[model samples]
Target: MATIRERAGRWQAIIKRKGYPQQSKTFDIKKDAEKWARQEERAMDAGTWADQSAAMQTTLAEALVRYEKEVTSGKKGADTERVRITKWKRHKLAQKALGTLKASDFAGYRDARLKDGAAAATVRLELAIISNLFNVARKEWSFEGLANPIEAMRLPTSKNARNRLFLDGEEARLLQALAPAARGEDGRFGDGCANPLLRPLVQLALATAMRRGELLALRWENIRLADRVAHLTDTKNGHSRDVPLSSAAAEVLRALPRAIRGPVFPITPNAVKLGFVRAVERARKRYEAEGGKDERMLSDLHFHDLRHIAVTALAEKLPNIVELAAVSGHQDVRMLRRYYHPKAEDLARKLG
Candidate 1:
């Protein structure tokens, strides 16, 4: 049954069905309301009209909770999904009913996110998560004929490959400042609370080009000391990679006292970050004291930049391009190019 009501100087068509709950939509005129009622009544008679308003009552937050439990766990990079879900829950979209969400609503959400000063890459990632949720709802969860509103919305262009790398002499100075053992009044190795684990971690990162999570997750069993390779099973690319060890890298690894527990780098991820922060602070203080103009040299250098340093070094040192790709575990040269820069001598030789 359908009924028309006037509320706040506008006409609304309300439809009540037996199996499903009631649904209502506002219209400008009585004829439009009557027309909609007739169309809905016919669709209901044919058993084809889905109660979209009832479906929409399921909020985005509720869908996110279901998605985290049902879908995200089975996928690659589930941790990333967890983070994305958290972000989505914080957004205005989370409060809206999933069924009532239109293409225009999503467009408003996108625009709002941009206005809030979110980077394009961040917005794109969030949108991808939302899009994936709708896809799951439609195909897997049996939300039949429910169109994805986000598909119709335009996305902002993401900035790729920001040139974050270590400048010359910065790496050496940073390493030098990271004391193996801080001196105390008694001048003992264990006197001060300097992290003995950090030096080897830095060297390994500069040698292997491994991500922070991969390095932190490294186990003693994965290390092939004789072959001079570190086997990385859990990687961003979802492929196991074997990172060859240089002599300097090997020496650092050999010097590290073995941990009795699970992880080779047994420090907490937070501890690792805190240690790096402290090291950077110390390095910055030293640089300023020395009257260097390049205060920005080590300021912008993240621990991840060590991987860039490793890749850049390999590209500059290795004669064969294919050989470099194999060792670095880069499937293509596209990403490898960003890290690689020819030495001044190599450039002079090429000119000659």
Candidate 2:
């Protein structure tokens, strides 16, 4: 049985049934209140009623916290995912209860973030984490009644892939700029760079095409100097690959003082990121001041761009996608091609 009555100028529906908990809801209209009461009662009778209590109790912030501890912490991208989760913890959406979260709420968040200047790709990644959290919350965390609000919500279009590759001579100029500070120079260095890892990091990246994470995670036990192969135990795709080191790359490895139990590079991701930024700024400023050719400073060069350059070189030499995938450790050929930005002038030479 259900009771519909006016309270505070709104209709309230309260349902009482045998073998089930009492359910109550308020609506602006009497008809809506009646409809809801009937539906809930019928669902209870049919054993299809979802207890809204759990969803109401859990919040997005709480969900993310649990997900991070129970799920994301075990993943390889745990650090990066934690950063995203933390960002969302401060978001308005995080304050909303899980039960109250609707597709409209997620849609509103997407719109707000886009207007706030977040890229489509970045927002998409954020939303993906949210969706994953909801999934794990239901299937793994025993929040089965909690609905995935984002499942049907429209997502932003994927961003155009970056094709930013190094122009000829740009790499040399950039490395030249990085060289001085990497040596041990205290003041106004032509060579004498300070950070010992900066020069070798850049050079090794160019040589092996390893990602920043992979480079930072590289160890002595993984490297065989005589065989010219570096065994990556855990790569991005969960599969290990033997990365063949070039003679130059091997020489760079030999020159580096080995750490007995620590990583080869021993640089944090933030350090590598900040160091690269500083290196680019100094390189650009010095090259322009010295009346360098082409006047194009390595303004946009990133550490990851070195991977792009390496893949492009490998694509040219590997004869086919399989061989390129082997060297690059790319699980998918399509993904591998994304980094292989070949020169237009070289392609045009085939027509000649």
Clashes of each: 1, 8
How close is every model to the real structure, measured as TM-score?
Answer: 0.74, 0.82
Candidate 2 residue lDDT tens string, 233-310: 888888888999999999999999876566898777777777788778877777778887664457666777788888
* Candidate 1 residue spans exceeding 4 A from truth: 5-54, 102-118, 172-199, 259-261, 266-295, 338-352
Worst 10 residues of 1 by lDDT: 184-193
Q: Candidate 1 has what TM-score?
A: 0.74
Model 2 bad stretches (over 4 Å):
4-12, 26-33, 176-195, 281-301, 334-352
- lDDT tens digits, residue span 1-352, model 1: 6999998888999988787567688888988998988897898889887656534667899999999999888865567668779878987878988887788877787788889998787788888888888888888876766778888888888877555777788887777766666666786654222887887788788887777778887887888788898887876677888888787777777888765446778776667667787787777777888897875777866676677777777777785667787677777777676656667897799889
Model 2's alpha-carbon lDDT is 0.82
Q: Rate the local accuracy (lDDT) of all candidates.
A: 0.77, 0.82
